[model samples]
Target: MKAVYIAKHGGPEVLTYGDRPNPEVAPGEIMLRVRASALNRLDLNLRDGKNYRGALPRVMGCDIAGEVVTISPNAHTDLKVGDRVILDNRTKCGVCESCRMGLDQNCTNGKRLGVDLDGGHAEYVTAPAANAHKFPQTMSFTEAAALPIVAHTAWHCLITQAQIRPWDDVLIQAAGSGVGSMGIQIAKMMGCRVITTAGSDWKLLKAKELGAYEGINYRTTPDLSKRVLELTGGKGVDVVFDCVGADVWEHNLKSLKPGGRLVITGVTSGTKASMDLSLLQGRPLHLMGSGGRSRRTFADMMKMVRQGSLHGVVDRVFPLDSVAEAHKVLESREYFGKLVVES
Candidate 1:
């Protein structure tokens, strides 16, 4: 099978596209003929030597949409060969206490695809059949592949961690990002007033098209907190959804109302930041760092996708062989939504 593998973590130039042995079918697993896989910030980080724990010569991709080629006899899923599906990518021990309690994301033995195992940056990949979700018949493979990682993470951060309520004022940073754009849509669906930031007017306008009520061009207004305060009539937003990390940490803290919450899912920007202790001392605030979602939460997100209530925004599609180019596009941070690769 032809695949892209990283022998050493450094840059896109390290990605090698060549033949790799086909994965064997394991009990309780399904072999998929890869159709499309979407790029995420995680992929960039893995390539750039951050948050990655896997060894070299690893296949790296998470958001996968494919057709079932074979189902292991030991698997109990209702899916069959030729069925179209999306990979969950969150590996968990189903019998673990956390998993039984619907907190699979907290499972003591949980592992993530691409990071912990070979992922979908190839012509073929294997996944636990139980982790595969039926794809919406209405969506193309590229669109289906774009939904899993970003959509689930956004839903988990906003609905699960933030516990957003209708009429709340929400602030989403980096509106053009996959998760950021999805966060804006999810918050809007819950009837919240959304204020999102982007580096360019084009992206800000695109964000509004996706449902954000106000767009802040961070390039023009570096300290977005001041503008956010002005937008909220100086009261600050009820929730600040941030993934940009340190670069906007202070701004995120300041843009929130007293007792408001800040839900963080990723740190795309530099991770370190300096802060004054008195900032939080003056006003009570809640800070939440959310990770992967449980199987139940992913199912809920799928329901929304099927019902057309939530949708992924695909900015471009690249062939699997052009994996390097895909990383370049993601690192450039110019795309307004998800970028996909078709195998």
Candidate 2:
């Protein structure tokens, strides 16, 4: 099978696209004819070996949508060969206490697909049979491929972690990002007023179209916290979904109302930030870091997608063989939504 693999941790240049040994289906696993895969910032970090190091020659892609090719004899699922499914990114030992409680992402033995195992950057891939969920007939493979990571992450951050309420004033950072695009729609779906930030005018315009009540151009408005305060009539937002990390850490703190919730998932910007203990204590804020969303969350988001309440925003699609170019486009941050690589 032809796949892209990283022989060593480095830049996009290290990605090799060529034929390799075809993956054989293992017991309790499901083999897939990979249809499409989406790129995430985690892919870039794993490629650079910044976090979650893996063995050499690892295929890298997390958001996968494909057709079932074969199911192991030991595995059981409602899906069968030719059924379209979305691969869950989070893998866990199902017998673990966390898994028993339906918190697969919190399992101590959890390993992410594409990070701990070879992922769907190829014509064929395999996943735990339990990780495959049948997608709606209305969803295209490209659309399903673009959803898992961002939708699950945003759902966990806003709904599960932040416990967001209707009419809450919410601020989402980097609205042009995959997660931010989903965050905007989810917040709006919950009846919250959403304010999102983007680096460019067109992205801000697009963010508004996706349901953001207001868009902030962070390039022009350096003190974005002040803008938040003004937009909120001096009270500040009730919840902040911040993925930019350290670069906007202080601003995120200041943009919140007293006791506001701030949930962070990614550190695209640098990871170090200085915070004032006095301000933290005075405001009694709830600051949380969320990652590795549970399978349940992914399934719930997919259900919303099927109902037409939530949608995946895809920016572009590249052929599977052109993964290097896809990486370049993702790194440039020139796209407004998720980037998909089709097999």
Candidate 3:
């Protein structure tokens, strides 16, 4: 099998595309012929040795959509050969206390597919039978490949953590990002008025097409909170879903109404920030962090996908051999939604 793997952590140049041994189907697992794989910021962090410190020579893709080819005899699943599916990258230890309690997101011994094990960057990949969810036939493999991480993250953050309401005024940071784009759709689906931000005016236009009620070009409007307040008629938004951390921390705080909620999932901008202690006590704000997502929430998100209410936003597609170039574009942050590589 030919795949992209990193033997030494560095830049995109460290990604080696060459022949590697085909993975064997282990018990409780299924092997699929990978059709498409999507890139995430985690891939860049792992490649540059900033987030992961594991062994080398690991395949580098987490979001996968593929066709089932082989299933271990002991695997308990309803799926069959030739079934098209998207993968849930988080593999949890079923016996863990958190897993046993139906809170698998907090599984103490969880291992991520693309991070802790070989992922779907190759022609074929193996995953736990339970992690494979059959996707609707109407969906394309490229779109399915873009759904898992970003959709799951946004769903978990907005629905499960923040508990967004229909009447709420929501603000989504970084409209051009995968999670940010998904957040806009999810918030709109719940009937919330969404205000989104992007670095460019064109990206904001794309965001508006995805249902963002208003778009703010952060490059021009450095004080994002001021515009957010004006959009909300001076009361500020009821909720804020933020992915860019420290760079927007103060702005996010100021953009929220008293007792409003703010859920943060990523920190692409630097992580350190100073918050006024007085604001927390005076405003009684609800600041929360989006942690690991569970299998249940993944299923909940898929329900929306199956109903055609939610879909993956594909920004660009690259062939398997052009994965290095895909990484370059991901790092440049020049595209909207996901960057996919077809096998």
Candidate 4:
């Protein structure tokens, strides 16, 4: 098999593409003829030495969409050979308390693909049967590859964490991002009134095309909080999606209405945030940091994908060997949606 991997963490240049041994299929696992695998911030984090250790060489990619060629005899009844599918990169120990409660991502003894575990940056990968979902007949492999992580994160933040409701006004920062663009769509799906921030007029127009009630160009209007207040007639938004932490932390906090909630799923800008102690009492706010979703949550997200209720807006496609270039593109923050790496 040919795969891209990192022997040592440093930068995207550490990603190596070359011949590799065939993946071993275990009981309840299937080997895929990988058609496509998408990149996530997690891939770049692991490659740049922020997340994983170099104890084991790593093939880094998370969302995988492919056709199954070989299946272990012990595999369960839900799937079989020749099935087109998308595999969730999240794994959980079934016996753990969180797993028993259906919170698989929070399992005490679990692993993530492309981080602590080997992932899908190859021509073949072994995926657990439980983590694979049959691809919809109408969806292409490239589209399927873009969904598992971005769509799941958007669903977790809007539907599960913030509990968004129809008619509620919401503000999403970095509206041009893969997750942010997806988040805008998901919020619109729930009938929420949404305002989002992008850096340019072109990006703001793109966000508007995706159903944002209003688009604010952070580059043009530096006084975003004041603008938000004006847009809402002095009533701030019901929720604020603040992935641009530290730099935009206080600004986002000021955009929310009294008793409003803020859902944070990432900190691509910076991790640290300086919160004013009095803001808690002055506005009566709630801050929530959400990570991966539960098994049921991801399944529900897949259901929407199959039903055409949610669609991942992919920006570009890259080959497995061009993993380094993909990282540089994403790091530049220029793409409107996701960039996938096809195997």
Candidate number of the best lDDT: 3
Error of 4 at 324 (Å): 1.6
lDDT of 3: 0.96
At residue 204, what lDDT does model 2 achieve?
A: 97
C-alpha TM-score for every candidate: 0.96, 0.97, 0.99, 0.96
Better of 1 and 3 by TM-score: 3
Please tell me which model should have the higher TM-score, number 3 or number 4: 3
TM-score quality measure for candidate 2 = 0.97
Which lDDT tens digits does candidate 4 get at residues 1-343?
A: 8898888888777889987788898888888888988878767778878765645587888888899898889877567789999988888778988888877778888787777777888999987788888868898888899888888888899899999999899999988887888889899989999899989888889899899999999988999999999999999999998667778888888899999999998888888878887989998998898875787888888888888987767888998889889889978888887788888
Error (Å) of candidate 1 at residue 147 is 1.1
Q: Which ten residues in a row have the lowest lDDT in candidate 3?
A: 48-57
What residue pairs are clashing in model 2? none
Task: Evaluate residue 243 in candidate 2 and report its C-alpha lDDT on the 0 to 100 scale.
Answer: 86
RMSD of each: 1.5, 1.3, 0.6, 1.4
Poorest lDDT segment (10 consecutive residues) of candidate 1: 48-57
